[model samples]
Target: MSIAIIGPAEIEAMIDREVADYPTDTRAGAQTLEAFQNARRKPRLVSVNFSGGITQKCYSVTRPNGDYRVIYLPLAGYFSLCVESDFGPLDIGVHGPAIACFGSV
Candidate 1:
Protein backbone atom coordinates (compact mmCIF):
# COMPACT_ATOMS: atom_id res chain seq x y z
CA MET A 1 0.00 0.00 0.00
CA SER A 2 1.19 3.49 -0.80
CA ILE A 3 1.95 5.73 2.15
CA ALA A 4 -0.23 8.75 2.60
CA ILE A 5 1.16 12.18 3.30
CA ILE A 6 -0.01 15.75 3.57
CA GLY A 7 2.33 18.30 2.03
CA PRO A 8 3.79 20.97 4.32
CA ALA A 9 1.93 23.71 2.49
CA GLU A 10 -1.39 21.90 2.85
CA ILE A 11 -0.86 21.23 6.54
CA GLU A 12 0.24 24.82 7.07
CA ALA A 13 -2.90 26.07 5.37
CA MET A 14 -5.06 23.81 7.51
CA ILE A 15 -3.36 25.07 10.67
CA ASP A 16 -3.68 28.64 9.54
CA ARG A 17 -7.32 28.49 8.51
CA GLU A 18 -8.47 25.94 11.08
CA VAL A 19 -6.44 26.40 14.27
CA ALA A 20 -4.83 29.78 13.67
CA ASP A 21 -6.35 31.36 16.75
CA TYR A 22 -4.71 28.83 19.04
CA PRO A 23 -1.68 29.75 21.16
CA THR A 24 1.94 29.14 20.15
CA ASP A 25 2.29 26.30 22.64
CA THR A 26 1.69 23.20 20.48
CA ARG A 27 0.62 21.17 23.50
CA ALA A 28 -2.95 22.35 23.20
CA GLY A 29 -3.03 21.75 19.46
CA ALA A 30 -1.56 18.30 19.84
CA GLN A 31 -4.04 17.49 22.57
CA THR A 32 -6.94 18.62 20.41
CA LEU A 33 -5.73 16.54 17.46
CA GLU A 34 -5.15 13.50 19.63
CA ALA A 35 -8.63 13.75 21.06
CA PHE A 36 -10.13 13.91 17.60
CA GLN A 37 -8.24 10.80 16.42
CA ASN A 38 -9.22 8.91 19.52
CA ALA A 39 -12.81 9.85 18.94
CA ARG A 40 -12.78 8.61 15.31
CA ARG A 41 -10.90 5.30 15.74
CA LYS A 42 -13.63 2.70 16.14
CA PRO A 43 -13.04 -0.87 14.99
CA ARG A 44 -15.81 -2.43 12.91
CA LEU A 45 -16.36 -4.84 10.05
CA VAL A 46 -15.77 -2.78 6.92
CA SER A 47 -15.94 -4.44 3.49
CA VAL A 48 -17.13 -1.95 0.89
CA ASN A 49 -16.26 1.32 2.57
CA PHE A 50 -18.60 4.11 1.66
CA SER A 51 -17.58 7.74 1.45
CA GLY A 52 -18.19 8.16 5.17
CA GLY A 53 -19.34 4.94 6.77
CA ILE A 54 -18.12 1.70 8.32
CA THR A 55 -17.36 -1.58 6.50
CA GLN A 56 -16.43 -5.21 7.10
CA LYS A 57 -13.27 -5.28 4.93
CA CYS A 58 -10.99 -5.88 7.94
CA TYR A 59 -7.91 -3.77 7.16
CA SER A 60 -4.29 -4.46 8.06
CA VAL A 61 -2.32 -1.43 9.24
CA THR A 62 1.27 -0.79 10.38
CA ARG A 63 2.64 2.72 10.78
CA PRO A 64 4.50 3.90 13.88
CA ASN A 65 4.88 7.63 13.30
CA GLY A 66 1.21 6.97 13.96
CA ASP A 67 -0.82 3.78 13.63
CA TYR A 68 -3.33 4.22 10.81
CA ARG A 69 -5.72 2.28 8.58
CA VAL A 70 -6.04 3.11 4.90
CA ILE A 71 -9.58 2.62 3.68
CA TYR A 72 -10.63 2.73 0.03
CA LEU A 73 -13.99 4.43 0.13
CA PRO A 74 -16.72 4.82 -2.46
CA LEU A 75 -15.37 8.31 -3.03
CA ALA A 76 -12.52 6.62 -4.91
CA GLY A 77 -9.80 7.63 -2.45
CA TYR A 78 -8.23 6.62 0.82
CA PHE A 79 -8.47 8.28 4.22
CA SER A 80 -5.52 7.60 6.50
CA LEU A 81 -5.74 8.79 10.07
CA CYS A 82 -3.90 8.08 13.31
CA VAL A 83 -5.11 5.08 15.26
CA GLU A 84 -7.43 5.48 18.20
CA SER A 85 -5.71 5.25 21.56
CA ASP A 86 -8.82 5.50 23.68
CA PHE A 87 -9.09 3.14 26.62
CA GLY A 88 -12.72 2.20 26.18
CA PRO A 89 -14.63 -0.01 23.75
CA LEU A 90 -15.26 1.24 20.25
CA ASP A 91 -18.62 2.31 18.85
CA ILE A 92 -19.22 2.27 15.10
CA GLY A 93 -21.32 4.91 13.40
CA VAL A 94 -22.60 4.73 9.83
CA HIS A 95 -24.40 7.26 7.69
CA GLY A 96 -27.13 4.79 6.84
CA PRO A 97 -27.75 3.48 10.29
CA ALA A 98 -31.02 1.59 9.75
CA ILE A 99 -30.81 -0.63 6.67
CA ALA A 100 -27.20 -1.84 6.89
CA CYS A 101 -26.29 -0.98 3.31
CA PHE A 102 -23.06 -1.60 1.32
CA GLY A 103 -21.31 -0.73 -1.97
CA SER A 104 -18.29 -1.72 -4.08
CA VAL A 105 -16.26 -1.17 -7.33
Candidate 2:
Protein backbone atom coordinates (compact mmCIF):
# COMPACT_ATOMS: atom_id res chain seq x y z
CA MET A 1 0.00 0.00 0.00
CA SER A 2 1.06 3.57 -0.60
CA ILE A 3 2.35 5.68 2.26
CA ALA A 4 -0.29 8.22 1.40
CA ILE A 5 -2.93 5.63 2.03
CA ILE A 6 -1.41 4.32 5.24
CA GLY A 7 -0.50 7.78 6.52
CA PRO A 8 2.60 8.88 8.41
CA ALA A 9 1.52 7.66 11.81
CA GLU A 10 0.84 4.12 10.68
CA ILE A 11 4.07 3.95 8.75
CA GLU A 12 6.06 5.24 11.71
CA ALA A 13 4.40 2.69 13.94
CA MET A 14 5.36 -0.09 11.58
CA ILE A 15 8.94 1.08 11.44
CA ASP A 16 9.06 1.44 15.19
CA ARG A 17 7.75 -2.05 15.69
CA GLU A 18 10.33 -3.53 13.34
CA VAL A 19 13.14 -1.69 15.11
CA ALA A 20 11.83 -2.64 18.54
CA ASP A 21 11.50 -6.29 17.63
CA TYR A 22 15.20 -6.58 16.83
CA PRO A 23 17.96 -6.36 19.40
CA THR A 24 20.30 -3.51 18.56
CA ASP A 25 23.29 -5.00 20.37
CA THR A 26 24.99 -6.13 17.17
CA ARG A 27 26.35 -3.99 14.37
CA ALA A 28 24.38 -5.96 11.83
CA GLY A 29 21.20 -5.34 13.73
CA ALA A 30 21.85 -1.62 13.97
CA GLN A 31 22.71 -1.30 10.29
CA THR A 32 19.76 -3.43 9.22
CA LEU A 33 17.34 -1.45 11.29
CA GLU A 34 18.79 1.84 10.09
CA ALA A 35 18.59 0.83 6.46
CA PHE A 36 15.07 -0.47 6.90
CA GLN A 37 13.94 2.80 8.44
CA ASN A 38 15.69 4.86 5.78
CA ALA A 39 14.16 2.79 3.01
CA ARG A 40 10.72 3.22 4.47
CA ARG A 41 11.30 6.96 4.69
CA LYS A 42 12.24 7.10 1.03
CA PRO A 43 10.57 4.09 -0.46
CA ARG A 44 11.86 3.67 -3.98
CA LEU A 45 10.33 0.40 -5.12
CA VAL A 46 6.96 -1.24 -5.14
CA SER A 47 6.62 -4.27 -2.91
CA VAL A 48 6.47 -7.68 -4.56
CA ASN A 49 4.22 -10.45 -3.39
CA PHE A 50 5.75 -13.89 -3.75
CA SER A 51 3.42 -16.79 -4.43
CA GLY A 52 3.13 -20.37 -3.15
CA GLY A 53 3.87 -21.99 0.19
CA ILE A 54 7.35 -23.13 1.12
CA THR A 55 7.99 -26.53 -0.48
CA GLN A 56 11.24 -27.48 1.24
CA LYS A 57 14.06 -26.25 3.46
CA CYS A 58 13.15 -23.64 6.02
CA TYR A 59 15.11 -22.60 9.05
CA SER A 60 12.09 -21.03 10.62
CA VAL A 61 8.68 -19.72 9.53
CA THR A 62 5.86 -17.61 10.84
CA ARG A 63 2.39 -16.40 9.81
CA PRO A 64 1.43 -13.47 11.96
CA ASN A 65 -0.13 -11.56 9.06
CA GLY A 66 1.75 -13.16 6.21
CA ASP A 67 4.19 -15.96 5.67
CA TYR A 68 7.80 -15.19 6.62
CA ARG A 69 10.97 -17.22 6.61
CA VAL A 70 13.63 -16.44 9.19
CA ILE A 71 17.04 -17.93 9.96
CA TYR A 72 19.25 -17.04 12.87
CA LEU A 73 22.85 -16.26 11.97
CA PRO A 74 24.81 -17.39 14.97
CA LEU A 75 27.95 -15.46 14.17
CA ALA A 76 25.99 -12.42 13.20
CA GLY A 77 24.04 -12.80 16.43
CA TYR A 78 20.62 -12.15 14.94
CA PHE A 79 18.16 -13.69 12.56
CA SER A 80 18.20 -12.73 8.94
CA LEU A 81 15.49 -10.34 7.93
CA CYS A 82 12.23 -12.15 7.44
CA VAL A 83 11.56 -12.09 3.74
CA GLU A 84 9.17 -13.53 1.21
CA SER A 85 11.14 -15.16 -1.54
CA ASP A 86 10.57 -16.82 -4.91
CA PHE A 87 12.11 -19.94 -3.42
CA GLY A 88 10.51 -19.30 -0.06
CA PRO A 89 12.83 -20.15 2.84
CA LEU A 90 15.26 -21.81 0.44
CA ASP A 91 16.35 -18.36 -0.64
CA ILE A 92 18.08 -17.56 2.67
CA GLY A 93 21.20 -18.93 0.98
CA VAL A 94 23.30 -22.09 1.09
CA HIS A 95 26.33 -21.07 3.15
CA GLY A 96 26.95 -20.79 6.86
CA PRO A 97 25.96 -23.20 9.66
CA ALA A 98 22.39 -22.73 8.52
CA ILE A 99 19.45 -24.66 9.80
CA ALA A 100 18.37 -27.13 7.11
CA CYS A 101 15.12 -28.88 6.33
CA PHE A 102 13.06 -30.70 3.69
CA GLY A 103 9.40 -29.96 4.26
CA SER A 104 6.66 -27.43 3.66
CA VAL A 105 5.61 -24.89 6.28
Candidate 3:
Protein backbone atom coordinates (compact mmCIF):
# COMPACT_ATOMS: atom_id res chain seq x y z
CA MET A 1 0.00 0.00 0.00
CA SER A 2 1.09 3.58 -0.58
CA ILE A 3 1.16 6.44 1.90
CA ALA A 4 -1.99 8.43 2.54
CA ILE A 5 -2.31 12.20 2.33
CA ILE A 6 -3.17 14.48 5.25
CA GLY A 7 -4.10 18.15 5.16
CA PRO A 8 -1.95 20.93 6.55
CA ALA A 9 -4.36 21.56 9.43
CA GLU A 10 -3.94 18.08 10.80
CA ILE A 11 -0.19 18.29 10.59
CA GLU A 12 -0.22 21.63 12.33
CA ALA A 13 -2.37 20.24 15.13
CA MET A 14 -0.02 17.34 15.65
CA ILE A 15 2.96 19.65 15.85
CA ASP A 16 1.19 21.97 18.24
CA ARG A 17 0.32 19.14 20.55
CA GLU A 18 3.84 17.85 20.42
CA VAL A 19 5.28 21.25 21.19
CA ALA A 20 2.91 22.06 24.04
CA ASP A 21 3.05 18.70 25.76
CA TYR A 22 6.59 17.58 25.19
CA PRO A 23 8.31 17.16 28.53
CA THR A 24 11.38 19.14 29.64
CA ASP A 25 10.53 21.73 26.93
CA THR A 26 13.86 21.00 25.36
CA ARG A 27 15.30 22.62 22.23
CA ALA A 28 14.47 19.47 20.30
CA GLY A 29 10.81 20.12 20.76
CA ALA A 30 11.02 23.58 19.24
CA GLN A 31 13.32 22.56 16.41
CA THR A 32 11.31 19.46 15.65
CA LEU A 33 8.18 21.50 15.32
CA GLU A 34 9.93 24.00 13.09
CA ALA A 35 11.36 21.31 10.88
CA PHE A 36 7.97 19.75 10.30
CA GLN A 37 6.35 23.06 9.55
CA ASN A 38 9.14 24.11 7.28
CA ALA A 39 8.80 20.86 5.42
CA ARG A 40 5.19 21.56 4.60
CA ARG A 41 5.81 25.02 3.24
CA LYS A 42 8.10 23.84 0.50
CA PRO A 43 7.73 21.57 -2.48
CA ARG A 44 9.48 18.48 -1.24
CA LEU A 45 12.11 16.86 -3.39
CA VAL A 46 10.80 13.53 -2.10
CA SER A 47 7.37 12.27 -1.17
CA VAL A 48 6.64 10.67 2.22
CA ASN A 49 5.30 7.15 2.01
CA PHE A 50 4.94 4.19 4.39
CA SER A 51 4.39 1.39 1.94
CA GLY A 52 8.08 0.75 1.53
CA GLY A 53 8.31 1.09 5.31
CA ILE A 54 9.54 4.67 5.55
CA THR A 55 10.59 4.99 1.96
CA GLN A 56 11.94 8.47 2.55
CA LYS A 57 11.57 11.56 4.70
CA CYS A 58 9.39 12.99 1.96
CA TYR A 59 6.88 14.26 4.51
CA SER A 60 4.85 13.45 7.58
CA VAL A 61 4.03 9.87 8.63
CA THR A 62 0.52 9.48 9.88
CA ARG A 63 -1.44 6.43 11.03
CA PRO A 64 -4.06 6.43 8.26
CA ASN A 65 -4.38 9.98 7.08
CA GLY A 66 -0.81 10.26 5.85
CA ASP A 67 2.75 8.93 6.07
CA TYR A 68 3.23 10.89 9.27
CA ARG A 69 4.31 9.11 12.44
CA VAL A 70 3.17 10.29 15.83
CA ILE A 71 4.98 9.09 18.92
CA TYR A 72 2.70 9.88 21.80
CA LEU A 73 3.75 7.91 24.82
CA PRO A 74 4.07 8.48 28.52
CA LEU A 75 7.50 9.66 29.69
CA ALA A 76 8.56 9.88 26.08
CA GLY A 77 10.01 13.36 26.30
CA TYR A 78 11.74 12.97 22.99
CA PHE A 79 10.55 12.06 19.52
CA SER A 80 12.94 9.93 17.57
CA LEU A 81 12.26 9.94 13.83
CA CYS A 82 14.26 8.04 11.31
CA VAL A 83 13.74 8.06 7.56
CA GLU A 84 14.85 4.90 5.82
CA SER A 85 15.36 4.12 2.19
CA ASP A 86 16.25 1.07 0.13
CA PHE A 87 19.84 1.78 1.10
CA GLY A 88 19.66 2.84 4.80
CA PRO A 89 18.40 5.34 7.32
CA LEU A 90 18.30 8.89 6.01
CA ASP A 91 17.61 10.94 9.12
CA ILE A 92 18.26 9.80 12.68
CA GLY A 93 17.41 11.83 15.75
CA VAL A 94 19.39 9.54 18.03
CA HIS A 95 22.61 11.33 17.22
CA GLY A 96 21.20 14.66 18.32
CA PRO A 97 23.33 14.91 21.45
CA ALA A 98 26.41 13.72 19.66
CA ILE A 99 25.97 16.32 16.95
CA ALA A 100 25.57 19.05 19.57
CA CYS A 101 28.90 18.11 21.11
CA PHE A 102 30.75 19.32 18.03
CA GLY A 103 31.02 22.93 19.01
CA SER A 104 30.28 25.08 15.94
CA VAL A 105 31.36 22.38 13.59
Compare the candidates by TM-score and give the number of the best one.
3
lDDT of 1: 0.31
Q: Model 1, 17-101: lDDT tens per residue? A: 4334543367855665444334332233344333344433432221222433323222322233323334211122222211111
Model 3 per-residue lDDT tens digits across residues 10-103: 5445556644664446786566544544433322224333334554433323221132232211122222333445543344433222112111
lDDT preference between candidates 1 and 2, better one? 2
Look at candidate 3 and give me any clashing residue pairs: 60-67, 60-68, 61-67, 61-68, 61-69, 62-67, 62-68
Clashing pairs in 1: 45-55, 45-56, 46-55, 46-56, 46-57, 47-55, 47-56, 47-57
| Candidate 2 positional error at 95, Å | 21
Error of 1 at 72 (Å): 6.5
Task: Pick out the ten consecutive residues of candidate 1 with the lowest summed lDDT.
Answer: 96-105
TM-scores for every predicted model: 0.21, 0.30, 0.31
For candidate 3, what is the total of clashing residue pairs? 7
Better of 1 and 2 by TM-score: 2
lDDT of 1 at 62: 15
Evaluate residue 51 in candidate 2 and report its C-alpha lDDT on the 0 to 100 scale: 32
